[model samples]
Target: MLSYARQTLKRVPSFQELLQGTMGSAKEEISVDVLVIGAGPTGLGAAKRLNQIDGPSWLIVDSNETPGGLASTDVTPEGFLYDVGGHVIFSHYKYFDDCIDEALPNEDDWYTHQRISYVRCKELWVPYPFQNNISMLPKEDQSRCVDSMIDAFVEARISATKPKDFDEWIVRNMGVGVADLFMRPYNYKVWAVPTTKWEQMQCAWLGERVAAPDVKKVITNVIHNKTAGGWGPNATFRFPARDGTGGIWIAVAKTLPKSNTRFGEHGAVTKIDADAHRATLKDGTVVKYQKMVNTMAVDSLVQHMGDKELVDLSKGLFYSSTHVIGVGIRGERPERIGDKCWLYFPEDNCPFYRATIFSNYSPYNQPQKDVKLPTQQLANGSKPSSSEAKEGPYWSIMVEVSESSMKPVDGKSLLADCIQGLVNTDMIKPTDEIVSTYHRRFDHGYPTPTLEREGVLKQLLPALQAKDIWSRGRFGSWRYEVGNQDHSFMLGVEAADNIVNGAVELTLNYPDFVNGRQNTERRLVEGAQVFAKSKKSVD
Candidate 1:
């Protein structure tokens, strides 16, 4: 089945060379000014920039047939779509916004949603940004948090230096109650690492990203029993109108010159001769370039280059895998769900750390309103009658599970367990009919911001840049502060600017500095044609 799908897709005009190279005997060698590895958002961003510049000949390649990397999406047999976890399109740069806007142009091309987020505690819904909303907590718990905040405020007055680790930073800012209740465990569930193992230097990303409590306001709210709303930069976000997040990238790729982009079999880069400035594809075609922009994970890139020193240096970095699970049900949207965007889970009641009301993103994410299907089972393990196929509308929920050596998961029954968890958490009703499900595991889901991460990246990145190779991206540079889709895309854009114009690569080096402001300097300019050839290409 996979082979037939590959063959059928290869017949597309844009994939002619890819098909010939994969199935035919004619292998070719070509050279360009630049070679890009990985067709994820970062790689696409670089390729798009290179195409705009028209300065250096370039070609972008990836192991996967489609783009998006960890930000991609998948569909179930019953026509339900789910992104890798809950992908929200919140941009910190105009370029990022423009690129997406250019791909999905119509008003109906996207779904704009206001963020409705919360933290699930002992049967209570704590408004997100837990530090600022202590009124939801029990009276005793509120007292503990307030006392610690006062103590931290006092300590800050006397201390001349900054906190040493994430734990200390939390204690110094949020106090003990909030930390013990939500900050510590919630972070662990998300990062898959202990708070102490994280460096304080990374706190800069959370500067304004996480809301700091206004002590006076909190006290007033607690006394008044007022609840806080979602507060922070990403209080609202956008999602693609179709094809999930991957649809956005695929559309972006379509806007680029066909000759410069490769996917599927031809996209796979099997061997890299760094000294020879050459890369070999699975079909035995060799491509040489003057400079290479690699967006693949640093470790994978090192292995492809066959460099011992680089591989050993990459070992200092650590990462956790992610499993995205989706559940599609046949019923009216639950009244309890309302318009919630995503919810955080800190306890062990469910293996997943977060769940998004995926159906809320777009009505088309599930089967059509008129499609007919049967119920597989109920949320409470009850069998539903095999009745006539009938449907009006459908909705879904996507859950994300982080896995590492410290936090292992049972892959065998993970889907079943997650479904049961949904029922336990009141996410779905006991007799709700289950219609579709989706699950995908990505090995490099997140780049851990461990205490040792900075030291290693300090040495590894420069060493590669010295070799005229710029390694930048989410996992490429290994900094979570700059690992989001926006940051990752800009990392590539900035890398290209640095290589072509000697512009300062701010996003690659100083994540805090770039993240602290609106970053207006990175906007797109009209008539900035970097490529000389016609944008049109022959199949």
Candidate 2:
């Protein structure tokens, strides 16, 4: 055993040798024109743009060994794939669409799934765009909702002032009945903010997030007992066929020159010296940069820089944590759950605000029907009849539970509580076999679009720029309105453009314009055209 141990030990460098190697690298000054601090969609976006320009020396680093950050996927030992949350490929920018297509060009690389979403309330599945499908609701609820919406329509004719907050916006467009029944409760669950705190959020972010019901159409639907169909950008979306959502990012990362990426512990940023224009990595390597595009949380970035005022200023930005739970069951895809993309849990039967039929998104998301796996336990927490391995057909569900100061989550029993909640909501049979389970909590999940968010960003972003640091991303910018995967990616791309030339960041400065309209300014097909024309010469 000692001889064998010596043989294994011989392959590894001595601590002294490792220390010296680290010291040697630390002493070497790695300089770049642009330094990207994260390799998520945002950082990758920045990196992609820089690579396309081919004029700047750039390095993109991420703490994780993988390329995707919050948008990454995880695989369970029992052969189940789950994403960070319910993420669908719904693009506002043609640039984003083109970039992803360039990475995974094959049509076979993705599975197109129609978004069949619904709200579970009072033991009934109400079709999504809840206000439009009031016919699906109980008669009492339908009557109340229609009556309140009629009152709101009448009230709006005389009221000239804008809504003071999101709560008021809901009351204005959706009416008090819908607000009380669905909007308010679901918002509280998903945002993890209390109804009272809804006033802290603004309505400007409400561009297309909510589908304002046409009162007449809704009334007609209720009268005719008909329902509504899908709405918004994600009405029909795409998911990668293999390796889950993370595969798309991994493919995109491969497009960039590998020499430019620094991932894993070696890439972890330990400290940032804004004055010196250098960043220290966890491996002790120091990077000197002309300008930095930071994709980390702004509050955390301030703490890393040890800037007291900036840290305090960043406090005004609100965000919620997300607990993602995945359940892999040893059974066939049930008829009842067929073709459902994701389901909402507005009622108290489930702890999760939203549950995605993950396996429905793609066949590759779960193990093949032939793969054998032993049951972990039953959904009811009862012992299985046998511990023997079983085969044929499996399915999975990915649920998201939000947590914030206003709403605390019990992390210890989260998985168990979630499974029970699933049973309560009839998502699974009490006797169903659970093969595998996964639970991970992301500290910075949804960036809250608070009333103070825009106010804080107005000051914080420009201040960081004064020091040659463009802090942008979901958390970096702290604008939930423009914090989707596409928006975040474009944020980085725009930031890179702003750094390279004096280009105006349309996505960053004018989110409403970008979100309201299709941004086709930068296209992959036009790359050759874009290449011939210098960005510096454009202005």
Candidate 3:
């Protein structure tokens, strides 16, 4: 054996090289008419619209190797798939639907399922939109909920101050009984905000979020012991048949020209020279654009821009972090969880606010029947008697737990706590063998519509626009009222249109108008017609 080793020295560039433009193949001063940051739904929407217009030089960049921000999916080493949380496709805009269909056109690309959601409370499963389904609750709960709703409804006719806060909104509409039983604890778990803080939370952010029960209809349903079937916009929704939700974005990205997109480490925005209308990438390449459509979190964009005044103003905005935990079990789907798409946990039994029957959404969500895997541990953390690998059918559950400075979580024990939560909530048995697990935390998960939200956005959005920056997306725009996938996508599409032809960004500025009706201003099929006409004109 030779005692000599070959020495290979690889030069790593310093931070100064990256800052001063000494790395990579990107040009020093590349310019575009429109520059989009982040390749998530919002960014893709902007790019799709820009490509459709065929009038501007545009480029879309993202730090992620693949698209989809919070909407992305992750697969464990054992082949179990999980999304960021529980994401269901329920479109409010025809343009949004057209864009999704254009991406995954085939009938086989999706799996449609009726919404079968429930709220777990007092060890009973109540139909979702809890207020409307109070009939399913225990006798005492039903009486309390109904009485309070009637009182609140009558008070609404005489009262004049709208609502002071979310707490007051719930009490004024849902009544005190429902608030104490479900709304209070459930929302606390989801938003990581205390019930008392609801008084400090604005009510406008709740547009279309909650459905107040019709007192007469609710009384009729309760009298008959009948269950409410379809209630929310997501009553009937679809999931991608493959690659999880990330598959949808990947398919969408495939439609855009690759030359106009940049991703991975090289595409991350390190700094933005708003004064110079330039953005610096992680690789030291600077992108100069006439107008930038920033899809990153507004706070994150502010941090990268290094703007002191904007940073201070952004302090008024508050957001909660999300912890997504996934558990893949090595067995067939259990009878208790049969066909239940998603379940809400309002009791103290579970650390998670919500749990989705992920495997039931699609067969591709779990591994094949033949894949072999050893049980890592039981849901309760007991050691497996046998260390050998086993195989056959499998099932999975995805859970979402919120965290913030107000609500701190022990990260080291989160997975274990989640497993225990599953057992406590009857989602999994103590002896259930867990094959795979996943835990991911997103910093800017839910943009809280705090009392100061309106005040901040009033000044913040216009300030960014003065610098030719359109900061729009879930976190970018900071509007939880219109923060769904469809709404986020349209925010980008509308932002692009606004930049190009002075079009109104209805989705951004007037969320109530967009959420309340079907927006059909543009169609994907019409886009093809326009494209053909434009090509003919050019020829």
lDDT of each: 0.78, 0.85, 0.86
Candidate 3 on 1-539: residue-level lDDT in tens?
01111242122333344456666445456667788999989999999998898467788999999999878999999999999878888887688888899999999999999989899988888889888888998899889988988999899879977888888888898889999999999999988998767766888877667887788888889899877656757778889999999889988999988768888987888899999999998877788788999999998899888999999999999999999999999888889999999999988877899999999999999998899999999887998999899985999999999998888989899899999999988889999999999999998889988999999999999999999999999998999988989888988998998898886677787676565632233343454365457659999
Candidate 2: tens digits of C-alpha lDDT, residues 291-358: 99999999999888988889889889888999999999987789989888899887777789999999
**How many clashing pairs per prediction, in order?**
5, 1, 0
| TM-score, model 2 to reference | 0.92
lDDT of 1 by residue, 68-104 (tens): 7777778888899988867778876778888889988
What TM-score should be assigned to candidate 3?
0.91
Candidate 2 yields a Cα-based lDDT of 0.85
Best by TM-score: 2
Error of 3 at 494 (Å): 0.7
The worst-scoring run of ten residues by lDDT in candidate 3 lies at 1-10
Point out where model 2 deviates above 4 Å.
1-26, 517-539
TM-score against native, each model: 0.90, 0.92, 0.91
Candidates 2 and 3 compared: the better one by TM-score is: 2
Cα lDDT for residue 398, candidate 1? 93
